[model samples]
Target: MESRKLQIRDLTLRDGQQSLFATRLKQEEIDKLLPYYENAGFYIMEVWGGAVPDSVMRYLDESPWNRLRTISKAMKGKSLLSALSRGRNLFGYVPYPDSVLEGFYKEAIANGLNVMRIFDALNDIDNVKESIRLINQLGGIADGAVCYTVDPKEEHTDTTVKKGFFGRLFGKKDEIVEPKKIFTDEYFVEKAKQMEDLGAKIITLKDMAGLVNPSRAASIISKLKSTLKVPVDFHTHCTPGYGLASSLMAIIHGVDILDTNIWWFGGGSAAPALELIYVFANKLGIEVEVNMEAVGRIRKELRTVREELHAFDLVKNFPKEFDPLTDTLPAEIDALFDKAIEAAKADNEAELLDACHAIEDYFGFPKPNLLVKEAEVPGGMYSNMVAQLKALQAEDLLDDAMRLIPKVRRDAGLVPLVTPTSQIVGSQAVSVALDRKKGNPDYSNPSNQFISLVKGEYGHTPVAVDPEFRAKITGSPEEKAYDVSKYKKPENPVLPEYGGVKLAANDEEYLLLELLPSVANGFLKRRRAEEWEAANAAKKAEEAAANAAAEAEKADDEPITGEVVTAQILPGTVIEVNVKPGDKVNKGDVLLVYEAMKMENNVEAGHDATVKRVFVKPGDIFAPEAVLVEFE
Candidate 1:
């Protein structure tokens, strides 16, 4: 059989870690695997972008720029290094000035990034137009990504309207309703063509939620192949269980490249496993050019890393013998059997709960359930919803929120559910659900982001937003796109010293501080502290000893009696405070609202009490476990 070589872009380091563990894969862990990745001969290795920059600094206390440079240097000429960019957003949620984007792209390419897959959540080419041009000018391949989403209605098909005998006699004829697809093959094909015309070397069908089925994947891939002059790549997730099938269909339909991962890191919310795809591709006379030996070594190393990062592992209860490839369990025991045995033998329920919780703190927040294949919500979006509801102690509102998502999305001009849009819609849906539960009318308390979305601050929506709905969300029905040209960069953009050390020494550090101000500042302070401790070990030890002695001397004093509620999980900015001094609160009442991980979290009261004081107010940033409110 004549061999058909199929190109594969590995997502193990970027999107795989992102989907599985909130992009908390440490630099050291990546360093361990970088050598193998360079020798593996993948068509493209996704080393940076997505949630990496923010997560690295926000959680891991590492520089995102350093990671990009390190990976680029390792993979210099061995293989292509690609990063995911959110178009004009450029890894941040809101749009940045062209000058900022230009600087970021220039720095990114200079740091050794070879390709940048640029995408817009709204599928509005206007959002990505400038980024694509900027990347190409910087000598990086711009893989233009068109977000894929299905219409809320049923699959498009011809509908027959039969006329009755009296109606036929009255000259009314039987009518056939043609299949009208909002997100049709033609629709995607046209979007791909537009990107191609804008000088995009490659077109990508980016199904972030794993929502595209095999049929649609084939149709889109075929249409893209026929219509676009450039190569077509498919990037989907395993959330809806459509990834493997859709990817196989894409390969069969002549897709230029496919996004896949290695076994353990892939699947669940990530992409399809490369090992499985290789077997299937081989059967179809397609050759996947990757070193199986390096993959095996990487898998072994990943198993160790997976155990170390078990708190973020989605499948915390997997049996060793359980095979993910065939979805088979060993004859001797299964996951259920292991769970039953552990439950029966466990002596302490508290210990078990503690163990479970430790694993839930992957990115300093609870990991979402990975079994969202049958769920109405995608994994990432569903996780955010659950986290937000859990924060408010409104777990019962999950059902209502999920039900409201479609309506909310429809009203938002049927925008593709990705990134900022998905989070915006999901968060607003929860808000609407909470409002309805509070006996208020729906959309009564829309979030600031939701209002911005309806006002076209992000970009144009796929369909024209309903004028009435737009007015209801935002006071005006007028639609206006945010003019990036008018954005003025601050005169003093350099980050101030944190702990007497300059936070940003160069353009890369400056970009970090610019894109994620709060996280970067916090990380820089922590870095300074760590460096101080390392450099002055004896001085730090003496200071720690003195502090310990002082703390012990003060321990004998009478303890404060008020119950203090501290921030849990991760650091966040206080957005609103509901409780004031002398205010009474119940166990479930929200004391304050804070924004964390892009979701607004409501800090609720644990018991009935009078509010003694609020330590944090709106715009105040707090760390995890810092006292937020004091109750009497």
Candidate 2:
């Protein structure tokens, strides 16, 4: 597969002139701009519109028709001079008939326009066909521009027309359903095919609002180029960050021509400049036929224009700073903008504007040339500022104190005085230290000195001072010599009484628990009772099993001393005993039953052993160590 080479069309003289105020260039300026574009290899130049001679002539001292003839004669070679015309309003404010459009087209061709770009805000196919027919009659290449600015609501649908007819015939009420208005790939494809059929040599997708995204551009351009036999071109503005993305996608999807500015004149609100396209095209292996050196020259010239215009305060009214050399904006400039933003958040407008001015001055312009116009801080910064303001208000230094003292405190390793004990003393100490550091006079009385010592030292650290001593010093009105007797010091005062021990059993621990009193009264009572019962039951059962085993062992050692050993009770045989320690038994009585697996055996006393004891009964299960019986 062979790769297609992309071509650049400079719209700076046309589009750039439109964006500027009334400062139109003279014929000399236009002549100078031509060589720059020619050197940049832009052969297709759109000079002026033909429909409105009066308005177009307002910018040039020479008539627009005569100027085009002169430019065409001066600029030799295969360079084509083109003019833009509309079937209706050529001046963008008034509407004219198709005959008027035809006459204007003929006159522009006669005056030396080799190409005609017929455009309309609304996609009226009849007007497009009439214009294309006129251009074909005059032996000039016609380019069809489909403007996307037409209100989608005005889009007509066959289904809607059919429904309206059916409703009117049936005497039904008029249905208020809105017509389908979404511009789809199918719609653009159809429009492209229609333009091609109307003898349009080229079809352009004119994106007025810069709303086209990359994915949409790729899909639409791919479909249009594949469906339409003519070459497809893209013209768009830079808005909402889609300009560069849309351009790249269009190129990848097979767009033949791209409209761009030489420097800062042609982009959207923040679109990539022409230099970016050249750089990107090289990296992507696409052969761009634009002269890079010429583009750089244009950029410097644009900067000169921006500086001259800003000198007159014309550029200052713009909301954002405009940079002609998009590639040269240093990363440090962004950091400076951030600093300016922070300074602005502190309500230092002078500092904020100063920072803004630095950026403007660096770019060789005034304010309102950058992308972001306003400085905004996050909620956290705002909250901190509010808190600092509150503190300043409380200290009654709201007039002279810095608005952002906490930021200074954090940077300086100064802790905030939160507690009342600390607030009274620590605040005074910090104030005195700050004032002294600033070379301010500090007048501390004896009472104020005592308060500072008590709170600043003891209130904030581990050392414990007697509260009574603090009271004596702070409360004394006479300001006389210190009375050591008034201050009662502890004999064996534990350091825990001060701030050493974090958890004091009776003070800190109990006090915290008291603060968050339990709300689950019934649940707590039941849980405690259940835990106690389970513990007691387990203890009693363990002790009883031990006692029973000990007595059973004693009985087994006696070995039928007072009674005959029953033959039914053999060693290693399992049995169930019914008595323990002191039970009476009669002669020839069965004392216990023994079982192995499911089979049962009985043990009968040969002679009455005075019937000492039985330990196991019905439902009583035991291991080998578990006692069954004990004899006296």
Candidate 3:
């Protein structure tokens, strides 16, 4: 009997880029890669949204809208394009009101988004219900996710909780830790069924951490196929190095689609190698169709992309000797699987988990990571924590932070390691460890974001938060679930300008900017200015680059005619201004005070400088990039 054909989905432009390059693969890089992806036989290409948009604005200093539109036009329906919908949160952590959600979805669809792969961090079906319904209402495919995790048995949960480097600092490690609710096959199947009922055209088994075993994956897929009427897709990472196995088992049990990336950026924390999987499936007599020529060309081209961005790409840490021509899984990988399974079957979960940890350690991982299966911290959270600590120059505290994560998460109600929840728990874990190191008394108090999460402001968690634990963080165990529609509506979308030159000329552009005004506006301003520089250059491109370089070096002390360092507040009300134009100030001195969310924030100078300009006066309400002070 013939096997059912498998549909391949490429995530190279989205998750793959984010995984390998920290999503620094610029729009131009994607543009160069797009023609190749267009012919790559992907069921759909994930080209926009997810971390890409956030990274574009924050790190790349580019317009995410431009990225999506450019790729969308290039693909020209050769394949459907999808994006990650963080449900109520969109790209940010806040659970924005439905009106804001509408703006995000509507604008994305209008700009050529075809699929809404929506998933809530907690697997809260309630949080995704509106998005699922809205995706169909707006003529987009709804792909709902059943995020994968292995809920350790009650007896085994204790083994998962470990201490960071500051293990001895946690003297308050509660002795009577309560058992977390065990997630069962039923839970996964039920979630899939709910997605099916909510108009999801596809159900995605999202194994972000690659913690799902072949046996468990088969069970979930079998149960989901029997229960749901929609096609089932699977998404996983190669970080744990077991993705190929889990994917094969999933396909055998009836997953209709699998997410992958080109070989060049395919492994590590990224997706399964699309080339490897295609060859493997075809060799196994599994029905699949692929164009080796197109894939090879793309792979060759990606090698160039990798080299061009070699400093940023982490794929070098992955297997170096992979040959895509012969669809083969390396014997080393097979050997690792043997060791991992043997560990899983050992006398205790600790032995099994240790073996798994040993395998991860065997692989030289350069990026952020906490791969202990017992802890089940998602890859994104682990990487994000590492990045955060590195930025703070305290990366030595990573091990301490890693060990602290499980404890902090459990204390905060064992919230699932997914989006806002992952970020919330992760940030708090860092805080706890940092406080412990500093002997700060408020080490246990979670930040406002974590407190809001405990209040049920984000949405329902898998299990009710522990009352005693809740009281420790927020002074009460009361969970704060709210009707998102009733939450304060986001302020009106506003336009950005420079010297009265309005940047967003249309409502669509304005709405896109509204998602992240300050970052997006600054990015657009810089990007457009660079383009203008390039186009109007009377000298060679190298000279223009050199001129920009020269200006950057003398930027702070010798700037005039609007080309000065500026600080602006977003969604803020300026209540105080500390200086006017031409005033001298010292480094770290506050230039002004603005209030956002009732919290006063100060704009400070990074270096001692004379004020070149003051863009705002006291009592002015301004959006992002409304300069507070320009430095000489």
Candidate 4:
């Protein structure tokens, strides 16, 4: 049997709005778009709800429920309706009241919505679980959303600076400040498990801010899929140029669902467009199963609708010769950016902001939200431009800034921002700059400046010390950095006797010998101790063996006592000779030597009697029956 196919969720209405004006998408416009999406074979359409602030929710002329109803009626017999709901919105961020969430979920589900997405900006598990409960109670499938944002603490080490910026701007800095523990692999896994336990049918990774790279997306999604039982999906923005790459990576990692826009509507300056993704996926043999012709038609119709509303003009003021495909960018765009970089070299706020807006306009319209407020602060645009240039590794451009710094600084009456530390910028930033300068951009490699920065802060490698030297060095609060080459094993030394020292069988003594240093010791203290212990052990073993040999020799030399003289002597018996044959002899004296079993037997007097007869000579072989002499 064939495996089940992955699901595709169309986020043209929700996430796509980031690229265009959401307010411009009226009910009638949505009505025209819904049928096309259905015909295009899209399974899930993420409509709206995540952007609803309390103040604006009431003012929403067409509510989320109303939009769902319209799309359901229009796309009958094709596609499920889905809406994104946030834990909170601008007016006051709060997890939607259970009762309110239950009502909204029931209304949408009753109106033909099949899935309700519960998203939190920070991927808060509790809030996601709460929404899941409400959705389940209302008889709708609940999806737990994990949004990707700049984890303030993870990306930037200083919470104080991050909090200050957000606190002054939004008055709710604490809401965004992550906990000190920071997110880890185990943490994400546990959160996924929690969502599954909370009855969420699907777990979606929402790349809200588009910070994920292709490699990161693949690793994260693959890990999540392998670790969790529920279905996994990926939602990403086109920021930083990873749009299509991230999607492909997600597919490679076994993601069960993916979110994409109809065209380039959801992409940023560097992001890959949906059209390109389809083209690439086709070439790579991934069966997306999307209708390209239908998508193209929708794109054209959407563009027509946007043009009629004059939405492009409202948000952006383009030059007379501006052409989105070719000539839209100002000739001065690069120059103005260079000038601001030079001015930033001198730390000139006014000059930098001026150049920033010019560059910003050249790129798009009302300026990116990230740059808008930052432009007002000193060194803001300059710092940002430096970061970008550093990221790009445009060395010639960097060289230009470096050369222009003194001149710009002298004119602006300010000290240059460049310092000794800047010289050590990482290779990643330099590499990016080099690539950009060459006009062949590769996002896979990071700028050199970034590498240097991280290395400078964290120190470079794992360190280990010789066990003997461990006592000499003091414990450090920081991580010990060691050269990798120092870790190779040394050759064992040859010892005298036993060919080589045979490792013996005692625990404490063996451990002490093993601890002996392999290299030259400054004081040879441990070496001396080990040598002494080995010698002592050997000496003791040798003495014990020698003593046992001496005892055996003594036992062999001892004399045998009297035994009965019989005609038949038994083997292993000590026989005694009593008498000898002579003219006259005294009694009770040794007479002859009797031998048996290849050993000479000691002969002695058997009784107090005179020797009557002599029996055998010393050279004669004897059996157990042989007798030497007899006494009476």
Candidate 5:
């Protein structure tokens, strides 16, 4: 085993909160944990970036920049603070101009970020170089991440096509396949060298899927440590339970740092718990000193905090009830994970990989999560899809959607599923499933995102995208790679004061508003008008409680006499009418189907009820709270 000391980075505030709470954690919520994190003696704390600003304005109605400032103040230089950046793209999907990059980083660096970890979804070195140069120019530690993805092919000799059943159906092999993504040691070494040459101080192996096996982790980490001069760190989700083993193996193979979180915010799509690794570290004879007592106290407090966040999500949509305090997983589940980490500590790579696979099979809680590797859904998109399906009252469609995802992904040139790509591919899958339900599957045409990708908006795909697909979408053969200087200088986002709200007082606030103007103004306007925000909060609280109670009652199989599918918020087009007057339907039988966002959604009988009337017919479009069927 490598004798080097292990450095641990805590991701509870960023990836952890994002994985478990849908990034709903606001500045105030994050504040309470900073002191403990500082005391816990981590090498770095991931406090800002990665869906934070977007989610802040979109969902939490808070300023992400201010959160960083507050966190920096709370740390008081006790620990290095890091933020995730999307290379040339920054936080937004489309590549911003060089001018925009400079402007954004000026505020970001000044706001107290010590380390900037930049990554591109496609592993395009072109996308990573400018960001590395800028962070170095600013004199901040620029950490470049090699976003990890792998092919399902067992070996180079295994020349099998990836799309299988779906590919043959759509004739998709002409588009793309998985062999190119088969991440070997050479791949990691190459990416790491590119970053190092660009003056990166650190290189992060970003395994967002938590799919890296211990043997693979050891091989890659060993190769990088031998080949590169810079330190290496591993970042992954605990969603599929493979992270702990992979992290342990990486550490044994001379990894400088690992990303983890507290137990409450760890596991189930989050990072591996620091406590679990503390166990592995002790066994491996690697000393990692931390305030265990303080960590325990913080975890206890955050358990309640997490529940409150869970209630917020559960009340609003189809989010499953989460309890950080309860280990509701089967005993075998914990055993499987413990075994994996143990094997890693013992340097038993085969056992560790087996344990990792076993743990992966356990993630979906009563259901097998084998689909994660197959579907390649990022954790963020996974949580979003769960709630979206619930809001549409179409949880039954989830499995169907998951099955259709591979084809949707392959059809889009098999772009690595991360961030913006994940959402784009995920939505397309939903469209495919819904469109197919209407018996007209659209495969030739691609979504706007796929087209934009073909046009080189987000950067290059790792595998060669289908030329025909590109031509069909972009009206061109293939998008030629371009320099960052080619794009026009983009205008600063417009910021306007609303309802006597205060305008930005400084560059930091202006950047926040610029990042998301409407969300910032909405929050700032309400921050000034306490009365308005309070009243709105109260109204939402009532709605949440009522929805919770209705859900609870629905679970008990109550006779739901009135069924309103659309909530009067989103208009729906009646696509299929499954029931008519005097028709008897079972509790789970579909009564009607409506089309929205190009997907078919169903209104089902909550309890077996006789249809008294059908309110809408095929081709009828109606607003929310539209009565689809009346039951007697």
Candidate 6:
């Protein structure tokens, strides 16, 4: 044992809520726990960043800036306040201009943000270089994260390559083969040193998927501690049951800080529980002085708050009627699963096991996801793919999509799957699977984001993308380098009164508006209207009723057209419309692009047709299954 003090960086407010409840934990719900967390003796409390900035405004109608300020005030300088930033991307999926980065960091530090854990999805030093510089210049600790991913020991070869009779006889059959090891321990060590060179105050090994095993964690942490002058922090999740063990190894190897959460919300897909780690560290003769009593109080209160947010809870959403031991196995229940015989007849073992896990999760049993471990994917990535497929109404294509993800990842130069990139790759994989199922050629109908990724727009992938594939995706034989300086500035929709709604009374509000325009716009408008209505009660009441009637009438008149094309999954803002009324289109041509789930989804034409009427334009928000275009 190293016998050094192991500091705990608490992630309950940000990643804990994000991992467990879809980041829908309200600011008021968080306000109740701040006092306890203040006394909890945590080294750092992560309260902002990740999906929090967007989720709070989009779902809870709360300002992310206000939440940060409130928590900082409540903490009273007891614990360091931290937020996660996605390098040049900030909180959004796409990279913004330098002005956006500068402004966002300035406001974040001014709001009492002590630390900014900055990372690039692809681990590109170029992408994060400016973010590290900006945060340090703003007097906030920039904890640079080397996003973690690993190559599989082997990969199953594609069966399509072994086609004809002679080819079948002479060609290598589809079989498992060793993958060239690219992300070795040395690769991580070099990346950490590069961040240190760039003036990162600390280096963090961010295993977003819990893919790092105990031994691997030990090797990397030890190497980082030895090679780097800055302190090393370990951040991992318990999605695949590796968080506790790997985090313990990190502590044993003299990791300066480790991330954890409350016991209840700590383990599945989140970090290890602070209480458990405190006890284990002490048992191993390491000093980790966390306030157990405060932790207990926070846990007690959070459990109650969790019940109030049951609608967003994954565990709570499982069917309550299933009882495998007593109730008949063939009983029909929720559509999430089928009766026993039908399920067995269809050979839907994956769905059956998922139902069992859901039941176990509902009953408060230990629900570990072995699929993530077996597949060697981070739990979040796996779940994101499944959700994407479900939303596309291609649930049956889940296996095809899942199998295609690794290849898609490899084809894109083996970029580490983290937020934005994980989402990008997963979305692309689903799109590819859907296209292939529809009899399109391989690599046909690639998303614009996917094309950008291959063309090196998101910075250099781990391994360079093959030149031929790059040409196919980019429509040019020669690869073109992307320059951030030349990138277009994001639209500033923070007018005093835009779309007949008040927005941006202050710089903080303006920052929110600029960072996430659509989400912030919707929330800010409602917030301003509520404030106005509170002051002018009688007049607003009458207007509210009239508006309600108008909304109801609009709801009844859903968009109708001959061969209407609809958004089949979720509501999103139309980011781009590539076609106009009366424009001719071919099968697989991207009609319009929408922003949803932090991804720019390209809606493609299903068949050759002419555009009769384009129902939406850029900046228009559409609902699930809303008709987007009409064809004749």
Give the root-mean-square deviation of each candidate in angstroms: 20.7, 38.1, 19.2, 33.5, 21.5, 22.8
Can you tell me which runs of candidate 6 are displaced by over 4 Å? 1-3, 156-177, 316-365, 481-502, 534-632
Backbone-clash count (model 4)? 20
The local lDDT score (0 to 100) that residue 577 gets in candidate 1 is 91
Give per-residue CA lDDT, model 4, range 240-295, as digits (tens): 34444566567656888888765435444222345544533444455665666677
lDDT of 1 by residue, 113-196 (tens): 989999999899999899999999989999999998877532222333334565445633434333345888888888889999
For model 5, state the Cα shift of residue 490 in Å: 7.8
Whole-model alpha-carbon lDDT for candidate 2: 0.52
Evaluation by TM-score, superior candidate among 1 and 6: 6
TM-score of candidate 6 to 2 decimals: 0.73
Give candidate 5's error at residue 546 in angstroms. Answer: 50
Ranking by lDDT: 6, 1, 5, 3, 2, 4
Off by over 4 Å in 4: 1-6, 52-60, 88-92, 150-181, 269-272, 312-632
- State each model's CA lDDT, in order: 0.78, 0.52, 0.72, 0.50, 0.72, 0.79
For model 6, name the residue pairs that clash: none
Off by over 4 Å in 1: 154-180, 317-376, 485-501, 528-632
Best by lDDT: 6
Among all candidates shown, the one with the greatest TM-score: 6
The digit string of per-residue lDDT tens for model 6 on 558-577 reads: 55556979996889999999
Across 1-632, the per-residue lDDT of candidate 2 in tens digits comes to 66568886666655445434233544565665556555667656656653223333443323445566766776563456766665444433233455455666666677677767776533546546777888888878888877542112222333344346656576334444554443566766776788889899988886645556556677788888888888888876554345655676677678898877654454433223565566445545677767676667766576555444453333343323343335445678666655554553354545644654555445443223222111111112233433554665544443222322322222212222211222233334345444545677542322353354343322122123345544544553222332324433112212332223222123312221221113222222333455457876888899998887887687566565333343332333545565445666666677777775567867665556665555456555545445454456
Winner on lDDT (1 vs 3): 1
